[model samples]
Target: MAAAAADEADDSWMIAQEWMVWWDRPSWYVTIVNTRIDSIHRRKREENEENERVEGERREKKRAGTRGEQGEGESRRTTGDRATWRRQVKRRR
Candidate 1:
C-alpha cells in the first residue's frame, strides 16, 4: 500500500514539473495574437484618419462648388463602390 502511494506521489510530482516547464516558456500563439491585434489597430487608425481627411475635403468642395458637382466624384468614391460598379459595367457590356 505504501509503494502504491509513493508511485502516485511521484507521478503527480512529474506532472507538476512538466506543467511548470510548459507554462514558463514564451508562447508564440500569444505573441502572434498581440502582433495581429496591434497591426489591425494601426491599420484602422490610418483608415479612420484618411476617411476624416476625405470627408473634410468633401465638405469643403460642397461648400465651394456653386453647381454642387465640381469635385472629383470618382476619385472620392469608396473602393467597394468602384469595384461593384466595375463588375456591373463589365456584366452590362
Candidate 2:
C-alpha cells in the first residue's frame, strides 16, 4: 500500500510542485525575460558573423589590389626594356 502511494506521486509531480514553490512570479514575466535574453544572444551572433564577412572582404580586396599594382608595374618595365633594346639595335645597324 505505501509503495503504491509512492508510485502514484511520480517524479514529474514532485518536480512540478518544487518548481511552483520557487517560481511564484507571473508566467508572463518569466517569458518576457527569457525572450529578451534570447534576442540579445541572437543579435550578438548575427553582428559577429557580419563583422567576419566584412573583414574577409576587406582582406580579399587588399590582396587583389596589390596583385594588380604589381602586374601593372611589371608590364610597364617589360615595355620599357623592349623599347630600349629596339633603339640599341637600330643604332648598331
lDDT of each: 0.78, 0.75
Off by over 4 Å in 1: 1-26, 66-93
**Cα lDDT tens digits for candidate 2, 3-90:** 8888778876989997896599788988897999999999999999999999897766555544444432233334456668779999
Clashing pairs in 2: none
User: Which tens-of-lDDT digit does each residue in 24-82 have in candidate 1?
Assistant: 76899668868999999999999999999999988777554533345654244555656
Q: Score residue 77 of candidate 1 by CA lDDT.
A: 51
Q: What is the TM-score of each candidate against the true structure?
A: 0.43, 0.45
Which pairs of residues clash in candidate 1, taking residues 3 or more apart in a chain or in different chains? none
